[model samples]
Target chain A: MKHIIVYIEPKDASSLKRTSYEALTAARSIAGDAQITAFAVHGSEQALATAGNYGVQSVVVAKHDLLSTYSSTATAEALAQYAQSVSADTIILSGNASGKEISPRLSVKLKAGILPDCITLENDGGTVKAIRPVYAGKAHIAVQSISDHSIIALRPNVFTAKQEGSANASISSFTPNLEAKHAGVKVTSLVKNEGRLDVAEADIIVSGGRGMKGPEHFPIIEQLASTLNAAVGASRAVVDAGWRPHGEQVGQTGKTVSPSLYVACGISGAVQHLAGMSSSKFILAINKDKDAPIFKVADYGIVGDVFEVLPVLDAKLKAMLHS
Target chain B: MNILVCISQVPDTTAKIQVSGDGKSIEKTGIKFILNPYDEFAIEEGLRLRERFGGTVIALTVGSETSKEILRTALAMGVDKAGIVKTDDILDSYNVAENIAGYAKSISPDLVIFGRQSIDFDSSGMAPMVAEMLDLPSISVVSSWNIENNVITAERDIEGGKEVLTCSIPCVISAQKGLNDPRYPKLPDIMKAKSKPIEEIASCHGSALVSLTSMVLPSSKRVGMIVGDSEAEIASVVTALHEQAKVI
Candidate 1:
C-alpha cells in the first residue's frame, strides 16, 4: 500500500475507541514505507493527538455541521472525498457496528473492494492479503483486493494496539460539501447499558446454556463472572428460551467473541455455539456430562453439575483473585 | 409501500464444513442447504409490513440456480413475488451488491430489507452497500421497528447498547436476531410454493473487486486438561487459570 487512511471512531466526543487504536497499529504493520493518515469526523484535539501514540504520522479531521451527528452516508462521503484528495490507495477501519456500517458504503463510493472483519493481514509482494473467518469462525478464507483501491475492516480485540513511535501526529481539517440529503440516516438517541460489560468487548466471559436449567439459576453463572470481572454470555438456546438477552447470546446468530478467557457453564458445545467462541485464548468448560462436546475445545474441563460446581468455582476464584 | 426482501442460501449451521479440493471454497456435497437464519427475520418483516401497509412484497437473491430454493421458502412465507439473478461463478460482495441493487432500481421499492449477515460469508455488507448504490438511507441490525406515515423509527444494537434511528421511506433495513420469530411454512403453503413461479434474471457479472485466495479449517490449539468434579478439581481449575493460563 502506498498511502493508507485509517478511519477513527470516537468513543465519546473527545476520545477514540480502543478499536481505532488497533486499526492504527494494523495500518502501521502493513504500511511498510507507506504514509499513514488517521481520518475522523468531529473529533476533539485530544482524540486526534492520541493517534500519534499508535504510530500515525498525521491525522485528518473531516468537519461539517451534518457530519457532527454520525450519518452513514455523510461520513462515508467525507471519507471518500478525503481519500480521493489525498490519493490514498487503502482505507483501514475497525469492524465494529459503526465501522461495519460505513466501510461498505465507503468502498462503493471509492469504487474499492472491502475485506470485512479481517483477523490477519499480510503484505505479499506488494499485495495485501487478509484472512477472515467465515461460517462463524468454523473456517477461514484468505482474500485479496482485485480493485485498485481497498478497504479493510479489522476485527476488534484481535490486533494489538502498540506504540511503535513517540511522535505526535500532525493534524489537518477537511470540510466536505455535504447536503441535507446526505444526512438521511440520523441517530436520534443511544441507550447505553451502563456498568454491564459487553461480551463482544470483554476480556473474560462466563457463559451459561441449556444446562443451567432455568433463568433463575443464572446467578450462579453471574457470580462467577462477577468474581472474575468478566462479561456474562449465554447459548442460543438459553437466549431463545428468554433466559437471556440477545446481546449476550454467543453463537452463530449472536455475537462472536474471542476473549482472553471463556468459561462455558452448562453449555453442551453445539457446533453453532463453538463457532462463536472457539478462538478464545483459554476455555474452561464445566458440565455434568463427561462427553459434552464443549470439552473438545476447552483448555480445562470440570465434569459436574453446575449447581454443585459453580458456587465452589466462584468462591475459589474470589479467593484467588482477591488474595 | 413496495417492499423488497433479499436473501441467501447457506449450509445448515449444524452441517460440517470441509475445504473443497480447490482449497478456495467449501465442499458442498452431502451438505444440506437452508435459508439463511437471519433472512428469516427479513422475510418475516417484509410480510408483516405488507400486512400492515398495502404493498407487494418481493423476494430476491443473487446466487446460482440452487439459490432458488430460498425464493420458494420466501414464497411459502407469503412473499408476493420472487426472482433470482442466476450465476454459477463465486461473485464477491461487490458484484453481489451490484446485482441486488440493479434489481431494486428496476423495481424501485420503497423499502429494502436483508438479514444482518449471511451465515456462509458472514460479511454483513449487503444492505448498506445496496443502500449506498441506490443512494438511500439505511439502518442495520434492527431489533425493533415501527413505521407510520412513511417514517421509520428503529432500535438497533450498537457496541455497548441500543441506538434509536429514524429515516423516511425509500430506506433499507437489515434484521437482527431478536427482530421477530419467523413463522414456519405449513404443509399446504409448502405445496403451493412449489408451484410458484421464480422469475430468473440475467446475472450482471461485473469484474469482482475481491477474490478468495484459499480456504482452511481453523486449527485448535487448546490444552485439553480434564478434571473430575471433586472440590480439589474445581480448586485446581482456579489455580490453573491464575498461574498457568495467567488470564486472571
Candidate 2:
C-alpha cells in the first residue's frame, strides 16, 4: 500500500487515544517504505507531535468551524477531501465506535473497499489481506480489497502499539469544502461512565454470570476485577435480568471480546458465551459445579462455590499483586 | 414519518456454523434462519415512532426470496408494508448498501432505520454507508432517543461511556439492544401477515468492494487444568497464573 493515511482519534484536545497509535503502528508495519501520514480533526500541537514516535513523519489536521463539534459525516468529508487531494490509496483507523462510523462513509466517498474490525493484516505480493472474526468469533475469515483505494479498521487491544523510531511530524492544515448540509448530525456531549473500563478494549476481564445469583453479590466480582485492573463483564442473562448494564454484556448478541486473560465467574459456558470469549489467550473458569460447561473451554478451573473460593482468591491475588 | 426499517435474516445464534465448500461462504443447509436479533429493536423503534407521530413504517430487506420470511416477521410486528430487493447472489457490504440506498433514493423517506449490525457479518457498516450514499445524517447504536419538532436527540453507546447526538428528520439510525423491548407477534397477527403482499424488486447491486478469500475455524488449545478450591488449591491457582501463565 502506498500513500497511507491513518486517521487519528483524539483522546482529548491534548492527546490521541491509544487506538490511534495502534492504527499508526499497523499502517507502518505494512507500509513498505510508503509515505505514512497522520490525519486528525482534533488534537493539540503536542498531541499531534506524538505521532512521530509511531513512525509517522507528517500530520494533517482538518480545520473547520463545524469540526469543533463532532459530526461523523462532516469529519468523514474532511478526511475524504484530504485523502483525495493527496491521492491516498490506503486509509487505516481504529475499529472503535467513531472509526466504525467514519470508515463506511469514507468508503462510499472514496469508492474504496473496507475491512472492518480486522485482527491481522498482511501484505502479500502487493495485495493487502486481512483476517477478521465473524459469527461472534466462532470462526475467522481472510478477506481482501480489490478496489484501487482501501480502508482498514484495526480491532482494539489486538495490535501492539509500540514506538520503533522517532521522526519530527510536520503539521499541516487542510480546509474541507463543507456546507450547511454537511453539518447534519452533531454530538452534543459525552456522558462518561466514570472509572469503569469497557470490556471491548480491556486487556483483562473478570466476568460474572447466573452463578453470581443476583446483582447484590457483584462486589466480589468487582473487587477481584479491581485487583487485576480488569474490566467487568457479564453474561446475557444478567444483563437481561437488569443486574448489569448492556455495556458489559458479552455473548453472541452482545459485544465480542478477546482479552489477554478472561476469568469467567460462576458462568456455565453456553455456546453463545463461548462464541464471544473463547479466543481469549487464557481462560480461568470458577464454578461450584464440576461438570459445568465453562470448564470445557477454560485453561484453568476451580470447581467450588464462588462464595467461598472468590474471597480466598481475591485475598491471595491482592497479596501477590500488591507485594 | 415515512419510516423505512431495514432487516436481514441470519442463522440462529445457537446454530453451529460451517464453511461452505467454496471456502468463501457459510453452509446454509441444516441451519435455521431467523430475523437478526438486533433488527427486532429496529423494527420496534420504527413502529413506536409511527405510533407517536402519524406515519407509515415500511420494512425493507435485501436478500433472496427466502429472506421475505423476515419481512413477514416485521409485518406481524405491525409494519404497514414490506419490500425485498430480491437477489440470490452473494453480495458484499458495498453491494448491499448500494441496493438499499438506491431503493431509498426512489422513495424519499423521512427517516431510515436499521439494526446496529447484522449478526452474520457483524460489520455494523450498512446504516452509515447508506446514509453517506444518500447524503443524509445518520446515528448508529442508538440506545435511547426522542423526537420533537422533527428533530431527533439520541444517546448512543461508545467505549466507556455514551454520546448524546442530535439531527433533523430525514436521517438514518441503527438501533442498539437496549433501545426498547421488541414485541412478540401474536398468532393471529402471524396468520394475517402470511397473506400480506411483499413488494419484490430486482436487485441493482454494484460490484463487490471486498472479497472473502478463505475461511477457517480458529485453533485454540487450552491447558485444561482443573483443581479444587481448597486453600492450597487456591494458592496453587494463583501461583500458576503468576509463574506459569505469566499473566498475573
Candidate 3:
C-alpha cells in the first residue's frame, strides 16, 4: 500500500488555512486503504485536531524554536527528516506561496519528483497520475510519478474538502537536528494588509483593469468588493501603469486565483488576465464594450459603464445581504 | 560581484495553444515563443546589479536549440554572457534543478537570480532547489531589493502584505513582476546580441521523477447567455445569479 503524507500549515497558532483542509481531502482521495499522515512544522494541537476530522490516521508535528517563525530551509529540513522517518512515498501540499517555496527544497533533499499546481490526481492501481495546467492554463499535462517517492502540490479550491467522521488521530512530535547554517535566511518584518483578504484566498474577487482609468478610480472597485465581502484585484495593465500594487495584480504574471465568483469590471479581458482567473467557478464581466474578451469566458456579461453599474450592483448586494 | 540569471523560453502569452493529436504535448506550430515575461525582470535586475557592482552577468537557459533565442534576448538586455544547457528531453523540475545546480557550482557566482516561476510549467522550484544544493540562502517572489556591504535586503509579497528579509551574499533571488521595468532592446544592441556567442553544454540526462501520462484541454465553460445593458436587467442578473447559478 502507498504511504501518503499531507503537509498542513497553521495560519496562526490556533487556526489553519482552508487550503490545508483541501490538501487533506486530496490526500484522502488518493490514499485509498493506505496510511495517511498529516505533517506540519510547529503545528498546534488545534490544527492537528482539525486534520483528524479529515480521516488521517496520524499527525506528525515537528517543533523547533526556529520553526516558530517561517524559515523555508529549516522547515524543509525538518519535514524531510520526518518524511524519512515515516518512509512516506507520496507527499501532498497546498500550492500556495509557502508550499511553492518549500516543496522544491524537499524535492531536492529527498531526490523525489514533484508536480506543482496540480488540479487533479487519481491512483491508477499503485501509480498515481496527476493533471496540471501548463503554458499558463492554455493547456493541461497529465503526469505520473516514476520515482519511488513524489511530491504533489494541489492548487487551492480545485479539490473539495469533505469532512469524515473524526478519526481521533494520534499525534507524534518530532524534533529535527538543524544547524546554524539552516537559519541563514530570516524574515525581518511583515507588514500586514489589515482588514483586507488576500485575493488568492478570497471566495469572491472584484477586479478592475485599465478601464478604471487611474488609481483614483479604485475606490469604487473597493466599495463593491467591501459590499460583497470580496477581495480587490487589478489587471496587469493597471499594475504596470502604477495604479495598483503588484500584489493585487491577477494575471499570468501575477497570482493565479480561483475564487468561487469573479467579477471583472472595467477590464478588457487580456488573455494573460484570463489565464489567471478563468478557472473561477462563476465569472461576471461588467464593461461598456459589448465585445470585451472577458465576456467570452464570463458566465454573465453586463455591458454598461462600471461607474454606473457598480454603485447599483453594490447597493443591490448590500440590501440583499442585509435583508 | 558576478551574477547569474536563469531564464526560460515560453509561448507568448497571446499564443494560441493547441493540443497534439496524440494528446501528449502542446502543438508547437504557429506559436510565437518569447522569454518568459517574469524572467525579463530577472535579466533587468542582473544588468542593474552588474552596472552597480562592476562584474559580469551571465544568462543561462536549459532547453532545446530554440532556447538560444531566449539567451540572445538576455544578451540584448546587457547580460555579458549567455549559456544554454542543451536538452530536448522533457525533464522534471528535480532534474532541471540538479542540472542548474551543477552548472552553478562550476561558475561560483556571487548571486543567482531567476524568475519567480516559469509560465510554461509554473513550477517555482528551480532557484530554491539550486540554493539548497549549493547550500546558500535564497528568497522568492522579491519585488524590491537592495544590497549594502554584501548584505541583501529584499521585500517580497506574502499573502496580504509584504515581508522584509535580510540575507548575506552568495544568495539566490527570484524576481517577481513590478520589481522593475525591463528595457526594450535597441537595434544596435539587438544586432550585437545576434553576433555574440552562446556557450552550449550537454545537459545531464538525469532520470525524470515524473512522466507525462497525457495532456488535455480544460473542459470549456458552457456558452453563457448575454443580458441586455439596461438598468432593468440588474434585477434579473441578480435573480439569475441567486437562483439559477447560486454561486453568490
Candidate 4:
C-alpha cells in the first residue's frame, strides 16, 4: 500500500490554512485505502482535529520550543525526518510561500522526485501523474516521477476541499533530531499587511491596471474592493511602474489567482496578465478600449471610462448588498 | 565578500508561445529571448551588494550555449564575471540544483542569489535545493535585505503579511520583484559585455527524477458579450452579474 503525507501549515495561531485542507483532498485522491497522514510542525490541536475530518488516518506534529516561529531549515529537517519515519511514498503540500521554501529542501534530504505548482494530479496505477503549468501558464505539461518517492506541491485554489465523515485520526508527536545548522536561520518579526486579504485566498478580486494612472489612484480600486469584500490586485505594468506593491501583482511574473469573480478596472489586458486570472469563474472587464483582449474572455465587458463606470458599479453593488 | 547570482533565459513576457508539433516542447521559431525578468532583480541586487561590500559578483546559469546570452546581460548589468554550466539535455529541477550546487561549492561564495521563480517552469525550487545541498540557510521570495557585519536580515511576503528573517553569510536568497528596480545597460556597457569571456563548465549528468510526458495549450476561454457604455446599461450588467451569474 502506498503511504501518503500532507503537510499542513497554520493559517494563524489557532487554525489551519484552507489550502492545507485542499492538500488533504489531493492526498486522499492518491491514497485510496492506503495510509494518509497529516503532518505539521508546531501544529495546534484545532488544526489536527480539522485534518481528521478530511480522511487522514493519522496526524503527526513535530513540536519544539524553537519551532514557535518558522525557520526554513528547521521545518524542512523536521518534515524530512517525519517522512522517513513513516516511509512515505508520496508527500503533498500547498504551494504557498512556506511550502515553496521547504519542499525543495525536504526533497533534497529525501532524494525524492519533486513537482511544484501542480494543478491536477492522478494516481496512474500506483505511479502518480501530475499536470502543471509551464511557460508562465502559456502551456500545460504532464509529468510523472521516476523515483521511489515523490514530493508534490499543489497550487492553492485549484483543488477543492472535501470532508468524508469523521476519520477519527490518531494523533502523535515526535521530537526531531535537529542540529545546530537548523538554528542558523531565525525569523525575527512578522508584520501582517493589516486589513488586506491576500489575493490568492480571496473569493473575489478587483484588479487595477496601468490605466489607473498613478499610485494615488489606487484608493478608488481599494474602495471598490472593500465594498465587495475582495482583495486588490494589479497588473504587472502597474507593479513594475511602481504604482502598486509587487505582492498585489497578478500576471505571468506575479501571483496567479483563481477567484470566483475577477473585476478588471481600466486594465488593457495583456496575454501575460490574462494568464494569471483567466481561470476566474466570472470575469468582468471595464475599459474604454472596445477591442482590448480582456473583453474577449470577460463574462461581461463595458467599453466605458473606468472613472465613470466604477462609481456606478460601486453604487449598484452597495445598493444590492444593502450595506 | 563574494556573491553568486543564478539566472535563466526565457522567452519575452509578451512572446506568442506555441506548442511544437511533437507536443513535447515549445516552438522556438521567431521567439524573442530575454533574461528572465525576475532574475534581473537578482543581478541588480548582486551588483548593489558588491558595491556596498568589496567583492566580486559572478552570474551563473545551467543551460546550453545560448544561455550565455543571459550571463552577458548580467555582465552588462555590472556582474564581475559570468559562467555557464553547459548541458544539452533537459534536466529536471533536481539535476539543475545539483549542478549549480556543485559549482557553488567550488567557489564557496559568501552569498548565492536567484530569482524567486523562473517564468518558464515556475518551479521556484532551485535556490532552496541548492542551499539544502550546500547545507546552508536559505530565504526565498525576499523583497528587501540588509547585511550588517555578516548577518543578513531579509524581509519576504507571506500570505497576508511580511516576515523578517535573519541568517548569517553563505546563505541563499531568491529575489522578489519589489526588491529593487533593475538598471538598464548603457550602449557602452553592452558592447563591453560582448568581449568578456564566459567560463563554460560541463554539467554533471544524472537521470531526471521527473520526465515530461506531453504538453498542450490551456483550454480557451469563452467569448463574452459586450454591454453598453451608459450608466443605465452598466447598472444592468452589474444586476446581471448578481442575478444571472450569481457571482456577486
Report lDDT (Cα) of residue B204, candidate 3.
87
Instruction: Sort by DockQ, best first.
Output: 1, 2, 4, 3
Candidate 1 true-interface contact recovery? 0.91
**Mind sharing the TM-score for model 2?**
0.97
In order, what lDDT does every prediction score?
Answer: 0.90, 0.91, 0.86, 0.87
Residues A185-220 of candidate 3: C-alpha lDDT, one tens digit per residue: 888889989888889889999999988888999999
| Interface root-mean-square deviation (Å) of every model | 1.2, 1.5, 1.6, 1.8
Tens-digit lDDT track for model 4 on B79-194? 99999999888888999999999999999999999998888898899889999999999999898989998999999887777899999988999998878989999999999999
Please give, for residues A163-250, the per-residue lDDT of candidate 1 as tens digits.
8776777888998988999889989898988999999889999999999999999988988888888999999999989999889998
Q: Runs in model 4 with CA error above 4 Å?
A: A166-169, A214-219, A240-243, B221-223, B230-236, B239-245
* Ranking of all candidate structures by their lDDT, best first: 2, 1, 4, 3
The candidate that achieves the highest TM-score relative to the unseen native structure = 1
In model 1, the runs with Cα more than 4 Å from the true position are none
TM-score of each: 0.97, 0.97, 0.96, 0.94
Question: Higher TM-score: candidate 3 or 4?
Answer: 3
Q: Against the true structure, candidate 2 has what lDDT?
A: 0.91
Cα-based lDDT at residue A229, candidate 3 = 86
Error of model 3, residue B165, in angstroms: 2.2
Ranking by TM-score: 1, 2, 3, 4
